[model samples]
Target: MSLAEAPFVGNASARRVHGFAAGSTALLVGDPADGSHLAEAVAELGLVPQSVSGGSAGDVLARLAREAAALATSGAAVPLTVFAADLRVSAVALLDLVDRPSARTSVAIAGPHEIAKDPSAFTLIRVERTQRLVHSVGSARHVVSAPNALAVGALLVAPEDVPAAAQLWAAAADDPWVDPALDPFDLALVALVRGGVSVSSVPLGPYDVRRGAGVTVGAAGSPWQQRLYGASRGDDGFFSTFAVRPLSRRLTAFGLAHGWSPNVVTVTSLGLGVLAALLTATESRAAWVAAAVLLLSALVVDCVDGEIARFSRRFSALGAWLDAVGDRVKEYALLAAVAWVSVRRGEPAWLLATTAMALTTMRHLEDGAYMDRTATSRSHLVPDRLDLGPARDLGPADAPTSLPGAVSRRASAVSWAKRVAHMPIAERYLVLALGLLTGSTQVVLWAITLTVAGALVWSQGGRTVKALLGSDGYERDARRVDGRWSDLDHETDLGPLARGAGRIAPLPFTASVVGVGMVAVCAWFIDTGRLPRVAVVLAVLAALVVGAGCRPSIEHRLGWQVPAALWGAESLLVLGVAATLPGGGQWCAYAYLAAVAWHRYDVLYRLRDTGSPSASWVTAVTLGVDGRWVLLAFLVATGASMQSALAWAAVLLTLVYGAESAAHWRAWLGREGALRSEVARREAEV
Candidate 1:
């Protein structure tokens, strides 16, 4: 393996580092007895630190500047981050300096002023890189030092700042007043301050400390890591306060000293979670408690992975996807166990468990769809949950926030039951724990099933009722309000679909799922032979969208516009026919399908992306008649023995997709939906 890609292990005396984007930028470690202190700190922040040892600061700067200049000439570039390497310093504080969005020539710690030679003198903090010096710091507080002050040692010199920074280094030698062999701070003093440069003082509170392991491990309140623990907690409940957060913090401490990476921690948690699933399946009383304990441990470990990533600056694309997929895997595995137990107990509770599983997948699908729409439109601080990319990949999206500090402490639930239910991981595990302990897994399933089904229905239903009652124009710009994400139509899009047949461009992932899913469902329908040959042939045609949709002959001529919609429509119609032929409460099937389809349509209308609000809204409402829900509904319809009735309902509902798809093609092809593109263009211009 390349040295850069080699796994890091805890070796107290070794210099640890992570390099990025290839050309070298030296790490100027200020202390050696400290054992690559700055280098390790830099590495923790996901950057490789280089050993920069020269006789003096001037010598070091001269060398690095020359190298940078050489690279510039060769069409390559290397930017440098210099650290003081002091044990008293916290690496967390250097993050802003590293990623500082400033256009400054050079940055250094707002050092103690020369005139403030005595302890009582003002620090003379000057910041030229940002407007914060003028915008935030009040006229009254400039000279006076605050109580929780940080000693700054980090400096960032962006590539644009290199030429001027290099000039300062060269000029320092000729200036007789400035020492030739200068220290880093002294160089900052002359090269920046004396040279009429601007410098800003970063918050010192969570960044600097008294040198000792105890300084970090001492009080739960002293170190940045401890502060991070508090910051990382979601607006959660008792389990989060008493169980998850506390345990996670302690594990954070353990991981830091041992130099554990986020992926390693995540894998460990997954293993424990899997073991818990196994034990829960055993259905023994003692095993139940242990399963709960293991399950809880897995959660804490799951949380720890994120904590360590934030702490050590090791956030990676893999960590993002792993964190998400790992939870889904663990949750579903436990649910599968619950289902198995339900089946063995001769309880229909297995159905509820499976329903929860299906709902979870659907929930993520919608969330993924939402993220895809906003992917490049805004820069996210915590990143979209589905964005499986490195932190650096984030670009200016007209919006951003750091994830750790995102949750509001004021966020709360009204009742205890609701609070527990709202606690996400804590609640999930607590419920699982209680169910296993009480040997009343069915009760938990009942609660979860009701909750999931109710939420899916109520939230969207309520929004629809509200929208109908207090109607808003589909052309309204949701981005005008901070509540854009929560707006019913934020995630759905009409785009080219309804605009003119802008083409039924399902995201690649969604398309794959739809296609493969149809093939599997069609295969089952054919093998059952319960279907007529005509119906079976229709099912094959539906599967053709997935099975042969990729073939050039089919894709080029038909594309996905017609055939894909036909597949969704035909499949639903066949199922609905089969379901309703026996006529047992087929109206329920109609209502259910309508509710789901209307939900998607409502969302798509607000986000039709067309210029004419009326056209966009009407077209989206007409074109977004979804039958995908029939896929899940059919499972229940068939299982419930209301076959013919629901089957006929499915056929009626099937027309939604066909009409919607045709409408989308006609609208988009007719250029009626072209307004959506114009809207984006206007937004870009803004």
Candidate 2:
């Protein structure tokens, strides 16, 4: 063996290893050292690694296999986790990775981009899970016909596979590369794959100490260092994804070393977040930009608070509860101020603003309540950042920070989910900043309204059905693995015609569209001058239908009772507001705007989910891709004077709309001898 491998190999016979204790999952620590940075991190998660040592990786495995079997339940595979003295990982993220469906020996490795600059890449070998092939962000570089190779760092092993691992480890140790030069991480990968183990990239961000430089527990000045410190698995927000995590982690890292607490960071974030709202709620142009910048800082600060909590081990149940409450308070203050600005502008978008806030609160509380009861502590709900005081305060001891992920946490057992449909938090704030910059209160209302409505429906609809009907809904909606095509996949070779036919059209949503449209059209012809009033009335009706359809149809599809009566009551309230308004005739257009706003947003969300076969490039020019822009274009055509909306309209129609209409209309009118275009294209998916 080479010099690097000598120490571990030489002491093989002298190392002591043990089997697991009763009711205890084995955490086997290898390669002990004086400073236990990683060992302490493992301890933070309440798993103190049973101290074990063996001469080689094989000896280590042999010991674990010999000892742990009797501790677990009969016929159950005992959990076995191996940690090196150097790796830093999120304990919760590690749990998710180990629990996820995988091979007998599942390994997680650092990505090429994640490690900064390490050339000793680990080849990734993932076993094909389905007949449908994938080629998106992760799969594009996949090596077809053979296991793809990429660098990785950690392994999550099932104890039963120890014999296989040991054999491979011995083979790797004998290789020329293993003695002096090979990375222990890469060796693990080699042994697993050579032993015929399938592999995938580490789902969580795990630190690999094999690299010459590592992120210190304390921050100094390296940009990459700061970003990594603040970052975690499953923060898929825009600013949080890119900006906030990086900047905030840098500050948090520094403060942590200098003796700062999570409570201090939380208080600072609360103050800054509230100040940002008050600033944006003003009429000054500069203040709008300032508000955006300050809001960005507040988010960054908000992020740091969590990092401090997690890193310092000072997290508390009460602190987590308060942090959530503060977030809602800040958002509410911001929304209330924005609503005030809208009324001042004489546009009356504050009506939509108030409606958005109420619904947003509902979505927030629902996610929080569900997560508190079921999952481990971590903010797992997308757009679930709002606060409601304790509904049922279950102690989820200071949730860990999750790395960037597909969605916050899994959204119930409901499958066929459009995972990337949630709005980016940074995009939401940027839109608000844009609206403020241009003094367009309507834009701000539109942004907030769609976000609130979509998230509320998406989070609550299925869960409510599950509670009402329990396991019956799951059985009814579950699809078997028969020979029928069922997904809205972009990577498959399915023809456009076949793809279109397979679209997931929820029948209840389709019915609601008809119900709302028929009602609107009949009201429109009642009086010539009252056309605008009719449009406004119709818009509110449509918003309710579209928003309702988001989750309502799922209930109907599964043969569950939908709260149609609740919807009927909401309709009455919509009419009551319309009739009671002092300036009903003047602000009526905004009502249509609100309805269409929710509908158009849902359309973009659904089209992407439905897997329309149109070229992605075509999506930019297509009206069905996003409806809010259509409303903006219409507002401009109707002489909206909010900061050159007319100019924007002129540009859209002259440069884009005519050609788009020709493209879409020609397809509808049988360019290929097909005539499927309906009279109204209001809810068209493609």
Provide C-alpha RMSD values for all models, in order: 16.0, 20.5
Error of 2 at 570 (Å): 4.8
lDDT of 2 by residue, 1-686 (tens): 11122212112111111122112243443554445544544443334466545465444544544444333334454445555444544343343334332225555544333544432333333322221111111111212122222333345556566555555555545544333332344335444544454433444344333422332122232322322342443545544556657677667756655666666777888898788788877867788778767766776777776676554333343345446555655665676667667667675654566566545543443343343223211212111111111221122335222222333345422332332234444445555656666656677778777865775566567566665566421322233232332221211212222223224432344544443453334233322324444444454444444333433213233222122212222323332333334332323323332332232222222233332323443333423211332233234235454234323433453344335424543553352232112211211311
What digit string (tens of lDDT, one per residue) describes model 1 on residues 385-435?
A: 111112211234442221112224454333444555433556666667676
Best by lDDT: 1
Task: Let me know the TM-score candidate 2 reaches against the reference structure.
Answer: 0.43
Question: In model 2, which range of ten residues has the least summed lDDT?
Answer: 131-140
Q: What are the TM-scores, per candidate, against the unseen true structure?
A: 0.46, 0.43
| CA shift of 443, model 1, Å | 1.3
Q: Which candidate is the best by TM-score?
A: 1
**What are the runs in model 2 whose C-alpha is more than 4 Å off?**
1-61, 70-80, 83-107, 112-208, 211-243, 254-271, 279-293, 309-332, 342-347, 352-423, 434-576, 583-686
